[model samples]
Target: MTASTAQDAVTAGFIVIGDEILSGRTKDTNTGFLADYLTAIGIDLSEVRVVPDETDRIVEAVNALRERYTYVFTSGGIGPTHDDITADSIAAAFGVTIDVDPRARAILEAHYPPGGLTAARLRMARIPAGADLIDNPVSKAPGFRIGNVHVMAGVPSIMQAMVDAIAPTLKTGRKMLSRHVDADIPESRLAERIGEIQAKFPETLIGSYPRTSDGRFTTQIVIRARDEDILEQATAAVQDAVSITLA
Candidate 1:
């Protein structure tokens, strides 16, 4: 099945664009934020890809993901430097002309003084031909949504603002409910039984995370499902399989 056409009815893809993230010069904290945000709001963040500040790669990844998911959110490469090529790459990906958007320009102009709006800063005003802007309250430079894709700033705070701005525009599905069980048994000991529970409850997603603290190895089993009853069933199955306390 295609990425968008997968079992989940509501899904999203994330594209992290920047050489900094690829080179490990800047740690990527936005992806996790997006995942948590999307998950909380009933959207599954199903796919994620990190690309450098290369135009062709950005264009390729954007095109592929836009076709594959219900929505594609791109972070980074929308800054005011020579390396901020996301806007141009996205325009190329949609086969549209890139030009200074008057609306975006107005926002940037309002944010910066006349002399402060340098040519480099104006670069953030460039938007694809057919797209609506996603507001950025943190930094006046706005992000835009084209087709199924929503582009946003790479900075954690700004990207989060853009996401909030775009949330109302999306078609959200049923919210996913999560239950975490702190199991006294080690992950290896409960692996087989958890596999059985997963097979028995196919609609829910179950994951076991192991951690060792104070020389004790324990596992945290997380159960996620849209239906509370099903989530309870999954939780009960895991609890019956091993000794666990609700978290």
Candidate 2:
């Protein structure tokens, strides 16, 4: 669904590309970081996708998500490795040629001289036309941005630094408000009561997270809303329904 670009709401989507991730060899860390960071900055993460390192797949995902969401962030497969085809796929998605962009080349040349610029390293400089370079503080090889997609390194630390660098450029909306209350109750017993409270507070979203560790059933009911008053009301209703005093 297309999210409203109103003054109070922001929407974002993420694209993760790599064969390692698709094959379950590498667990994704960027998505959780992006979700938490963007939520704190008032950008709702509407969708996330993980695709294999294939040109056609990447191009299709980029085109679809870029048009659907206000901002799109991609991680993985931008390195100097042989399977790193993110830049070319991104160029194809935007219907442009992959070339040694002067700005990108200048950025790289300052770090790696002509003789030092191997084919693998030069692969990082081949950005699409009219794209801006994203600063990667962890590595000399920079990520590039085109349209709504902000491409970054797959490594967690580097991706986080890139995110910090680009956050200021985005127009963030009002932050989404949230409240949570935990109780030592089972989900099967709490589900009906929680449903009742949710129906009463239509604007608030209620979620029940049940965890059974150490042979104890612990449940957490979280209330999420765009409005503070509604969140407060829903939280109170949940507490009342569950018969626990929330701290």
State the displacement of the C-alpha of residue 122, model 1, in Å, after optimal TM-score superposition: 1.5
Off by over 4 Å in 1: 1-8, 243-247
Model 2 TM-score?
0.90
What TM-score against the true fold does each predicted structure earn? 0.90, 0.90
- Which candidate tops lDDT? 1
Tens digit of lDDT per residue, candidate 1, span 10-50? 88999999889988999999999999999888898989999
Scanning candidate 1 in windows of ten residues, the lowest lDDT window is 1-10
Instruction: Tell me the tens digit of each residue's lDDT in model 2 across 152-239.
Output: 8898999999999999999888788899988887777789889888888776678999999689888998898888887898898888
Instruction: Find the 10 residues in a row with the least total lDDT in model 2.
Output: 1-10
